[model samples]
Structures are given as C-alpha cells and as structure tokens.
Target: MAGTVRKKMSRFNSMISLDEVSRIVKAYSWKKLSTVEVETATSVGMIAANTVVATKDFPPNPRSLVDGYAIRSAETEGSSPADPSRFKIVGKSEAGKGFYSAVSGGESVEIYTGGILPEGLDAVVMAENATVSGDTITVSSSVKAWENVASRGEDLSAGTVLVSSGNIIKPWHLPALTDGGIDRLTVFSPMRVAVLNTGDELFPDAPDHIENSGMSSMMALLPWRFSNTLWIGQVHDDPDDIARAVKESSDRWDLAIITGGSSLGRKDEVPEAMGIAGAIEVFGGMRTKPGRTTSLYSLDGKPVLSLSGFPSTSILMADLIVEILLEAITGVSGYRIRERLPISSDITTGSGYTRLIPGTLVEMNGRTMVAPASSNRGMRLGSLLNSSGIIIVPEWVEGYHSGDLVEFRLW
Candidate 1:
C-alpha cells in the first residue's frame, strides 16, 4: 500500500514562485497557540499573549534627578555667582524617605538623586551651583520651573501599555516591565517542533555521518533559533518508515521538519511519504537557488516542511520557510535584525529565479560593504560559517553591482 502511495505522489511534483508560497502560507487561518504565565526573568524572547499595562506611575512622585536642593523656582530667579541668593535648608529628603513638611518661601529641602521632591517645590538646584553653610544653601544659578525634576508619571503613567500583545520580549524590555510592577507576564507557549531526518546514509551515533548531516546541525540550531525541538531520530529511504514517522510527529508536535528526500530523484521519497501520511502538499518547489526543492505540507492544519538534504540548502530554506511559519503562529517577525548595505562586488542572477547568497560584511575604505562568501551552492559549509547574513537577489532584478545598495537579511 505504501509503495503504491509513493509511486502515485512521485509524479505530483509542481513548482511555484516564492512570493506565491509566502502569500499562501500567510493566508492560512492559524489558530492562536495556548498561553502560559512565566516570571519576567524568564520571559525574554517569548511572545506576549496579552498587553502589559502600567499599574502605577513610574517615579510614583516627583523626584530629584541630581544631588541638590529642592526649592521654588521663583526663589532662584536672577541669581548668579556674582550675586548669590541664600535660602535656609529646613529639611532633607532621601530615596524611600520623604520630607513630610512643605517648602515655604525662602526655604529649600536638601535632596539626593532619586529622592522624592518635597511639597511646594518645583525645581532642583545642583549642589555645585549652590554653596552650603550650616543649614543654609546659597544658589548662584537660576533654575527654571520643573528643571532637574523627574515629574510624576514622566516615564510612564498608570494604565499606560508597556508592551503590546504579540511583541517578542527583549532584554531591554525587562527593566520597564519590572518598573511597571509586572512580576509575571502571559506569553504564548513555546512551539514544540520535531525533526525527522530521512536518509539511509545517516546515523546519530556515527560521528562522520553526523558531522556531514544537515539534520545534526539542525538539531543543534533549531532549539536556539525557535523553541523546543526534539530530534525524533532518523529513517532510511523506505516509504512506509518515512510516512509513519511523519504521521507520528505531526500528531504530537506543532510542526514537523523532514530533511532529505525532498528533490526529484528516485530516492527522494519525502514528498510522496508526506502525501501518504495525509499531508496536503502546500507547495512542492520554490523558485530560489540552493533551496528550490524546498516543499511545504499541511497535516491536520499543522505545517510540515520538507527540505533538501544538501547541508547549506537545508539551513537556508529553514531560515526562509520556518521563519514565516513562526511569524504566522506567534505573530512576531523572524528577522529581528535586518540592514541595507552596499555590495562590494557585482552579483549576477537568472532573470526568472530569486537567488540567495551567503556573505559577510567587510570594512573597505572606511565603509561597511558586503562581500559574497561564495556562489549559491548547497554544500558550501565554509560559506555558511563565514557569512553573517544572506544577500537576496529578487527575480525581477537580474543582479546587483559594486556600490549598489541591497537588503541583507541577518542570521
């Protein structure tokens, strides 16, 4: 039965433009994943499930930005070194401890940085700008109203949204969330992915095969790149074995990635096996170099992408397709870092196909320029390591020349 299924699907090969494939993936109605509550410390890199609002004003009260004296601005008007104005220091305010008394005319409160400004005080005079003599502060410079005072709600007000739903939490966002009194956040549960390496030549225990296998590299990279990923082990070129693995993995994981057997050769049985496993072929091929054989499938609404066995091609195709799927599920764009840089040399491409080339940015003549690491070859592992990003050549454009600006998609 499996042999007949494989034979029928082998003849079902089709090709489509990359843009059309992207549009198709985007158009799918993806159900939102379940949510989980995590402590703010561990929430970095997770997508927020709900908007986080500030419960109270940041600084909560007017505070001093410098170690100085809090006084009414009118008292310091027209004061300078030549004609200093002296005011009695009636009290002192420190962080977490406030001066309960208000500042009256001709009186100031000695305050430190982050200290709450006493009542009736609208300005802070730097210590260097004033001379102190036993309970008296002499101001030599005029301070404008609200100067050096971090006003209440200046940083964030109550009910202000600190982070919107679907935003990927970053390290820098931690401080703001902590200050907003958010101890915990609701975030989408990390996607669970299963990688099934289909090939008779590969073995998990064999060092030589593992070193050369794209599956091995993916096992190490996927967890860091996305979320939880499990290596469900490898399979030979048997149609039944591949189909069984695909069905089992799809049933348990949010996504299943099958590496190898994605091309047109006789041994390439992944596309057929996927069909036998009840996966509808979303697309069989992409019009992109190094990864044109890349294919996508849907099993019970979950995604399963079949990638070429060639090492570099598998990695590049994953970057493109997996990122799109992740964005669809998590509502976060994959490329956190992208830049437009000048090409250091000319790159030619076929007019009908989109090309992706690995390259590294180099400093030339005091300007940052991108140098193509190597041609778009599937097995060029050296180029993959040396390159910091991929240089994309669109289908409409034939190529790019030296000094021409191009978009570089960072890894």
Candidate 2:
C-alpha cells in the first residue's frame, strides 16, 4: 500500500520553486468562504471580506483648535501692537457647545479648544494676542480665514474607503473606523485547524516521551483567534493509524497540519497515509533549504501542510507557509511586515535553493542593519530565540557579501 501511494504522488517528487507553489495555490478551486460581522473595536486580526467606507464625515462640524476668540478675519486685518483692533465680547463657547448668536462686525466670541465654531465666524485669534477687558477685547495680530480651526470633513470625507477588501484589520485602524461612524465590519469567518504530531517516541505518558516543540511552536505562531486549531496529539509511525487520523481531521477541520513523516526516512508514513486518505498532491517538495521537504496536499478542497519532524524546520515552515495557506483558503491576502537592510557581515548560500537565515537587527555606524544570528542552518533552535527576523536569499543568488541589502521579514 505504501509503495502504491508513493507512485501516485511521485509525479511531483522533483523539487519545485516557491513560485510554482504560489501558482498552484492560486489556481486551486476552493469553496466559497463565509463572512461574519464583528464590532469594529474587536475586529483586529480579522480579514476584511468587503471594503469599509466612511458613512459620514469625520469632525462633523468645524471646531476650534485652540482657546481663542472667534471673529471675522476682516476685523483683525492690519491689527498690530502699535495699531490694535477692538471688539465687544458677545458670549463664550465651550466644547460640544456653540454660541447661539452670530458674531457680527466689531464683535468676538470667546471659544475654547474643540468648541464648535460659532455661526458667521471664519477665523480665531489667540487669547494671548488679544487683551481682554470688561466686554471688550483688543487684537494685536492679524488673523486669516479658517485659521486655527478644524474644518468639517477635513480629516476624513464621507465615502472614503477606510479598509479595503482582502485586508487584515489592524489596531490602528479602529480609531479612524470609529470616527468614520463604522460600528461593525464585515470579515472572513475564522478557520478551524487540526494539528497532528506523529512518531512513536512522542508518547507523553511514557518515560521516553519527547517534548513536541514543533506542535507547540506551530500553534503559537498562528494568528490568535484567526486559526482556531485542535491538537490531535501524537500518532505513531504506523500507516493505518496515520491514515485514520488524517481522514478524521479532514472531515472536521478546514485544514490539517501534520508534523513529521514527510521525508523518505524508513519510519516516514505520512505520505502513504495521505494517499490512503485520498489526498491529492499539490506539491511534493520545494527548493527551500531547511524546509525543502515541505509538501502540500489536498483532500477534497481542504489543504494539508506536511512539515519536517525537526523542531527548527517545522517551526520556520509553519511561520512562513501557514500564512500563505490561510490566505489562499480565505481568499484574502494578509500583510507581512518586512524591511530591506544591508547585512553586517558576509554569508554564503548554495545555488538552486532559497535560504531563510534567522538574524537580528543591530545599530552600527549610526544605521540599522541585520546580522546573521547563527551560522548553523539545521537544528539550531537557539537561533530562532535570539533572532528578531528572517533574512531571505532567493534561489538565483548564490551568496551575499557584507553591506549587501537584502529583504528581511519580521516574525
């Protein structure tokens, strides 16, 4: 049964580039995803299913930016310390309150910061620039129209797009959305994921129980509240047991992540189990170092990401690949924070494989730069701990010299 399964999935046995993986992922026919309406305040990390536009203008009315006297700009023209302008004080305006009467020629209204601009008032003169007495104020400086006041609809206009479709909601976006009168947002529904850890040595109750760091790290890196996952715990290296688990998970979860048994080792049974469970091959291998054995398969329309059993490799693959899979399934492209910085030292990579090197950002010579965290690319879990981001070297490039600018993706 294992041999037959291998033959069926062997067409993609050769290594493929990440570009090919992207093409295949984009071309896959996925089922229509449902959208949910969530409160704008709590929608951070959710993918926007539709564009959110402002319902009304922000700063609904013109308001005072500083505590000053609201007056006609023409009244203060040519006014200075030597030749001042005087006006009679009509009334005071506070925030959320406006003067009921309009300020005519030779009249001023005392207005505080954030107070609604009085009717017929087009400018404001700072209190320090005006001398106040009983019902009279003298202005020593000239004022311009609409100066020191927030104009209506200046911050955000009605019908302006607050959040575009296929964008992930962020915390900073909430304030603008609320100001734009958006109480709720339409976002893609959260996905259910099942994580399965394989290998006989992974038994937890036994004395030989190995810590499943791969499973723990994968779960931790996924965006909280977005990828709702159920840990299937550990399954032994038996093909039948693995196949049963895969089938059951595929039935219940939107996606499945199986760690271990992806390579051609003697104990590797995940490939055979996937075949038995009627999984179709999407890509067998990738041209990426440390995660070259990372393979993707599909059962029905759901995807399964088969990662290496090695803790470091699995964790890195999860950080990079899971996001792509989620975006593909939800039909929403999420944003990744990345920067291009010059390397502090030289580093070498083999040809024909894209390399992901963990690194830290350092300030040297008054400029921010990236320095390689570990020379060892395999089984270096400590590298991940000390690193702030990943340094990517594409397949076409052989290596990088010191001071060469490269793209870095923040974890």
Candidate 3:
C-alpha cells in the first residue's frame, strides 16, 4: 500500500507557489516523539509537552508589600501631621512568621516586607510616614483599604495555568514556574536531523572550499536553532550514491537535509535520487528568488528538504522550511521574533516571485533602518556574514522605496 502511494506521488512534479508550499508544510503530520521530565533549571530551550498549573496562591496569603504597619484603614482616617492618630503596636509580623493575634480598631501590627497581613487588617502605612515611640505608632498619613498590601492570589491564583503546553521554555519562564510550585516539567525530546552534502567538486578538507560550503555553516546553524543535527558528510554527485546516503540517514534521523545538487543542472541529481530512495516529492520548486529550486520530499514518514547549493539561498531556504518543520513537530513556532523597520534605500524584485534579501540594520539619524547587503552573486557568502536579518519582499509587491516599512526576520 505504501509503495503504491509513493508511485502515485512520484508523478507530482508541479512547481508550487510559496504560499501553497507553506500550507503543505503546515499540513504535514508529524510523528510523535518521546517525552521526558527534567528539572526546571535544565528545561530551557525544550518544548513543554504538558501545561503547568499553579499548586497554590502565589503568596498563599495577604502579604505586606512594604516594611510598615498593618492596620484597619479606619484607624488612620482623620490623621494629619499636626494631629496624628495613635495606635498601640501589640506585636510584630516578619516574613514567614505571622502574628497570632488579630489587629483591633485602635491597634496595628509592625510588619516587614513579605510579612503576612494579620486578620482584620486591611491597610499598611509605611514606617517612614509614622512616628514610633515606646509601644505606640502615630500615623499622620491616611491609607486606603488594601493599600500597600498584596492580597492573596494577587500574583497568581491557585489552579491557574502558569505555562501553556507546546511553549518553548525560556530562561525568564523558570522563576515564575518555580514560584508556582513547579519543579519538574515534561518536554518533547529534541528532533534528530541528518544533513547530507552532495557534490563532486567539494573537498571536505580544503580550507577555502570547506569554509565557503553551505553545509559547514548549516551544520552549525541547525543544532543551535532546531534540532540535534549531524553532518553525515558529502557524497559524490552520483544518483545511486546520493540515494543510498539519503535512505540510510533518513531511517536513523527524524529528518534529512540535502544541500547542493538541488538545481536543474545535469549534475543536480538530488531531486531524482530522492525518488530512487523511495521518497515522494511534495514540491519540486518554489516561486521565490535565490531559492526557487528548493524542494521538499517525504521518505517513509520523515521529511527530506533539498536546498540550493548557494550559501545565501541555502541559508534563506533552510530558515523558512525548518521553521515550518519545527512548528509541526513541537507545536511551537520557530522564528518568533520579527520586526518591522524602514528600508534605508529603494529595493526591487522580480514581478512574479518573492525575494529574500540579506540586510543589515543600523541607526541612521536616530531611527532604525535596514539596508541590503552588497552581493553581485546570490552564491556569495559575504552578504550573509554581514547581514543581521533578511527582508521578505512578497510575490505580489514589486519592491519598496526608501523610507518604506518592511518586515524583517532577525537572525
């Protein structure tokens, strides 16, 4: 049955628009990965598999927000600097140690920051605003009900959802989760990806070629952003060798990426080799500049993305495709940070295709502006090295003029 499905899909050679490709990528069904419980300290960068709920109120009781006196609001009413109201300080309430007695109408409890507000006390007066003498406090300032006091459940109520499922755990989320009584979290295991570099002219050891290879930079970029990626090394531009390398790696890894030989040249056998390896081509090409030859395939249940060999094109295509894959697998979106900044100069694009141009953001005359990086060839590595982000020119829009606002994806 699977073989028949593959055979039918093999005839699908149509080029898809970028929007259609994005939709197809979003609709893909991802295989479930195993989940593991880890300490909150170690869970940063992992996707949460379960929502975390607050076990109790954040403060668990009404607490003082300042070092002062906890008293009934009426006790401080009609008090002034010239004619102050007097209250007998019966006891003190320090943090973690609550006063056993209730505060009466003429009484107040000396309370420190984080100290629990005693029963019948609805306000607090800062110590600086009161005069303390012997066992009595004279308050000249009147406080309203619940003033300077944090009520129970003010920060987070018991049973409240602190963190939603499918969220990528960040460093700032740890303290809140910890305060809500969450010590451990269940998160999806990081996806394992295999990268294959296919080309006949490529040398693994040649310093210049290796430095210029997209595979080398992608190898560093992938593990940092999306998954545990391993470069299975390069294969000669032979259909059979490429097929074997892809098939073997796809079986062991969650996804496979083939860089180089993705274009339509005679030596560009990746798309054909993907079929020979029992993979179904989902899309052959995209209507996008610098990466029009980008292709996606499905081997068994795993996805295999074939990207352009050019460094600039390969980087842009990987960012787009891998983000979709990450969202599908983890139920969380990658590339979360996007900024809209004004273009520093006029930019043009082809009429029928989307254009992705590398850009560097700078402050000019006290305003943030993005300028396109210079590169005569799309294959050059200089543009990518100097760029902090990429400008996305939509398919319908021809271009943008200077001072036009454009959306950019930061690196």
Best-matching candidate per TM-score: 2
lDDT of 2 at 96: 74
Q: Report how far residue 199 has shifted in candidate 3, in Å.
A: 1.0
The per-residue C-alpha lDDT of model 3 at residue 406 equals: 93
TM-score of 1: 0.91
In the range 1-411, model 2's lDDT, one tens digit per residue, is 777556645644698887787778777875545678999989999888898899999789888899989999988889999999998999999887788886678999999998888889988888887899999999887899999989998888899999998888889889889999999988887777788889887886766878777777766666775767778778887778888888976656777888987775455577778889998878888898878878888888888889998888888887777767766766566456889999999988878988888999999999899998876535488888989888989999988999999989888
Which one wins by lDDT: 2 or 3? 2
Tell me the TM-score of each prediction against the true structure: 0.91, 0.92, 0.89
Runs of candidate 1 with Cα error greater than 4 angstroms are 1-13, 203-212, 223-226, 376-379
RMSD (Å) per prediction: 3.1, 2.6, 4.6
Please tell me which predicted candidate would have the highest lDDT against the true structure.
Answer: 2
The full ranking of all candidates by TM-score, starting with the best, is: 2, 1, 3
Q: Mark the regions of model 2 whose C-alpha exceeds 4 Å error after superposition.
A: 1-13, 204-209, 331-334, 377-379
Q: Which candidate would rank higher by lDDT, 1 or 3?
A: 1
lDDT of 3 by residue, 1-411 (tens): 666445434433466777898788878776666688899888888888888898887888899999999889987787899878899999999998999875667899999999999998998999998899999999887789999999988988879887787788888889778878889989887777788887766765644444436676677665452367788878877878989988776656887888887765555577679869988877788878878778888887688889877776787788778877777767775445678999999877757787788899999989999998855455356788888888888889988999999988888
